[model samples]
Structure formats: C-alpha cells, structure tokens
Target: MKKYLGEGLLIVFSVLFALFINSLAQKYQTSQKVKVAKESLLKEMEQNQVIMTQWKEKHSKILKHIDEIIKNDSLQEELIKDHFLDIGALTGQENLISSLVTSTAWETAQATQILSELDFDTTQELTYVYELQNSIINSTLPDLVDIYFQRETHRKESLLPTLIQFKLHFNEIVGQETLLVTLYPGAIEKLQD
Candidate 1:
C-alpha cells in the first residue's frame, strides 16, 4: 500500500510539471508575437506621420493662397477676367496633393486579432489616429475632388463660390492632418514601450 501511494504521488507531480512547462512556452510565444506586432505598427505609423506632415504643409500653403485670393478684390478680378484660366496654374493641380496614405499595418493587426494583445491605451490611441486617417481618405478627399470636378458654365460667376468650398474642405483636411501628426508620436512611444 505504501509503494502504491508513492507511485501515485510521482505520477501526479509529473503531470503538473508538464502542464507548467506548456504554460510557460505559450507565454513566451505570446510575448514574441506582441514584440513583432509592435515593431510593425511603429514602422507603419512613422511612415504615415511623415506623409501627413508633408501634405499638411502643402495644404497650408494652398489655404494661404486661397485666403489671399479671397481677401484681395483685385486678385479675384484678375482671376475672373481671365475666366479662371490660371486657377489651376495658380494653385498646383489638386491631384498633386492627393497622394495615397497607407494604413496596411494597422489594418493587418486588426484583421489578425493582434490588437487585442496590445495595451488598452495604445490600442485606443492608434484607433483614433487611423480613424481620422480613414476619414480623410474616405470622406474629405472625395468631397474635395467632387467640388473640383463639378462643372460651371460661367467660370467667372463660380470662381468665388468654388474657392469658398475649396477653402472649407482644405481647411478640414489640414486640421485633420495636424491632429494626426500630433497623435502619431504618442502612439509610437507607447508601441516602443
């Protein structure tokens, strides 16, 4: 009876040890995954921040030009007299400032369920930044394009109105970009930590 009791004790200990080892291995794997995900997210966010800054500067310049044209009656008259022929020449082509901003890493992390592994604050901040980016890409940009492409039979009559609408959209996009530029560093720091 004593021998049987010893054997039973040994078997129980062996099983417990195996389970502990498996649990530790799983934890190590998870940590490694989190590290890789953080690295990818950091790199992607850095690239996006650079792009947003560049576009923000471009949009700011365009906004300034729009303000100048709107404030000065002579400038408006010159544009109107020319039938707005030099409008595109005055303000660089709209398409030139509309470069594609990417969010592939953020999207991939979401799709793969890796964001669940990230800390709550980091995830929340990243979501906010990406949502703003999506807003710019999906909504603001399309509205700007629509306004630019909308036909006007009398360019002189429509110049002021078109400039006003363009100013509104550009102002919105620049504000969003500025917010994104500000948010990016915090997100990157969290990821690095």
Candidate 2:
C-alpha cells in the first residue's frame, strides 16, 4: 500500500510540473506578441511623422511665398506662427497626440487671422502652389522620431527583425502623402491596408 501511494504522488507531481512549464511557454509567447504590437505602433508613428514633414515643408514654402509677395520678414515669421499656431509649442514639445493637435489648431487660428489680412495677387498665389513640390514641411517629425525610439529601447525583449523591416517600410513611405495622415477622422481608414 505504501508503494502504491508513492507512485500516485509521483504521477501527480509530474502532471503539475508539465502544467507549469506549459503555462510559462504561453506567457513567453504573449510577451513576444506585446513587443511586436509595440514595435508596429512605433513604426506607424514614424510614418505619420514623415507625412507631417511633407505637410510642414509645403506649408513653409507657402508662407515664404506669401512673405515674399507681401515683402515683409514679419509676415514670414507671422505665417509660421499662424500655420503652426505656436512655433515654440512644436519645437521640442512632448505631449500625447490629442493635446498636440489642439495646440496646433490654436496656432493655426492666429495664422488665419494674418492670412485674412493679406491681399495676395493671383500670380503670386499660383507661384506659391507651384513651389509646393519642392518645399518641406517642418512639422513635429524629429521630436516624434525621438519619442518612438525611446519607447522601443525600454521594451527590453522580443526586438525582432520586424522592427528593422518596419523602419525600412517607414522610410519608403516618407514623403509619400498617400501614407501621411492626421491622427483623427479618416486617418485610420487611410492608414489601414
């Protein structure tokens, strides 16, 4: 009877050991998946920065053109203030996406006030539009890049090749306005394949 009891206890221990190992393996897989999700999110944010850069370049040229037309350096700076709403806010500002947009809209209101005051000629406006292709949007791109890389360094594991691939994909998409989009409204529809 003692021998039989010892054999039963041995089987029970074996079962429990197997269950624990399986649970650990599952947990490891889950951790990897979370890392992957975080990596993908970072890539998405990078691509959005590219789009923002393009828009900033275009807007800058537009403002410069307006300034040239108006023949005032003040107008150029004012246009930057107007388009960005707050130059300082964008320079190295760190905030979540929602608050950033709100701040930008505020600066834009100021720019619009200035734009409204202008009496631009059709030829000058047409020339501004023509320059759009060459101009670079200097929006919140650099800072955005910094934030993403910083976040990834903290992940500590499951830093797969997909992270590099995603960076490559982002570089390819940069300057491609089709991929650039605002954070709200139809952005998801535009972003998702």
Candidate 3:
C-alpha cells in the first residue's frame, strides 16, 4: 500500500510540474507576440507621424493659397489665368486632398488578433488612431474638394460656398490628424513599458 501511494504521489508531482512549465512557456510566447505587435504598431505610428508632418506642411501652403484666392481677387484671377495657359504651377496643390494615410500594420494586427493580447488602454488608443486613419482613407471629402477646385479653376467663378465646404472638410481631417499626433507618443510609451 505504501509503495502504491509513493508511485501515485510521484505521478501527480510530475504532471503538475509539466503543467507549470507549459504555462510559463505559453506566457513567454504571449509576451513575445505582444512585444512584436507593439513594435510594429510603434513603427507604423512613426511613419504616420512623418507623413502627417509632410501633409501639414503641404496643406499649410495650400491653405495659404486658398486664403489668398478668397481674399484677393487679383490672385484668383492670376491663378485662373495661369491655370488655363498650360501652366502646371498649381498642380501639386490641386491634388493635395488625394493623399491617403495608411495603417497597414494596424490592420494586420487586427486581422491576426494580436490586438487582443495588448492591454485594454493600448488597444483602445490604437483603435482610436486606426479609426481616424480609416476615416481619412475612406473620406469622400477629397473628391468633393477636387470637383470644387476644378469648378473654381475652370469657370473662374466665385464659389464661396463650395470653397467653404472644402475648407470645412479639410479642417476636419487636420483636426483628426492633430489628435492622432497627440495620441501616438502616449501609445508608444505605453507599448515600450
């Protein structure tokens, strides 16, 4: 009876020890996954920050030009005349709204369920950023702005309402981008921690 008891105890201990090791391994694997996903997200955010900075710079100039058009009749006339005479000066600014901010890593993490492994706060922050990115990418505001820009350029007519609409949409996107800029550092810090 003593021999049987000892054997039973040994078997139970061995099973428990195996389970503990397996649990530890699983935890380590999860930690590594979280680290990789976080690093990918941080890198993605860094790229976005750079893109956003460029966009802001370019758009600042475009917005200044738009302001000049709205405020100075002579400038509007000049731009319209220039636009018609085979001058491609404003081409870059005209296509300003067409740039898409991508979030490929975020999408990949979402698809792979890596986001679930992250802490709640980090996940929420990323969700917000990605949502803003999606909003920008999926927006029809750029199309509307392009059409309005074409009309203004071709007709040389005063389309204050159309320009106002474009400005409003553009400002909305800028505001979202600003919020993303604010959120990224905190998210990156949390991920590193």
Question: Which structure is stronger by lDDT: 1 or 3?
Answer: 1
List RMSD in Å for every model shown.
2.6, 22.1, 3.3
Query: For candidate 1, lDDT tens digit of each residue in 9-95?
Result: 999999999999999998898888788888998998998888899899988888888899989878777655755435464365554
What digit string (tens of lDDT, one per residue) describes model 2 on residues 3-55?
99999999999999999999999878666654443344334444544545555
TM-score of 2: 0.33
Position 14, candidate 2: lDDT: 96
The parts of candidate 2 lying over 4 Å away from their true place are 66-193
User: In lDDT terms, how accurate is model 1?
Assistant: 0.83
Q: What is the lDDT for 34 in model 1? A: 81
> Highest TM-score: which candidate?
1
Candidate 3: regions farther than 4 A off: 82-100, 140-154
Q: lDDT score, residue 132, model 2? A: 33
The backbone clash count of each candidate, in order, is 0, 6, 0
Estimate the TM-score of every prediction: 0.86, 0.33, 0.80
Pairs with steric clashes in candidate 1 = none
Model 3, CA-based lDDT: 0.68
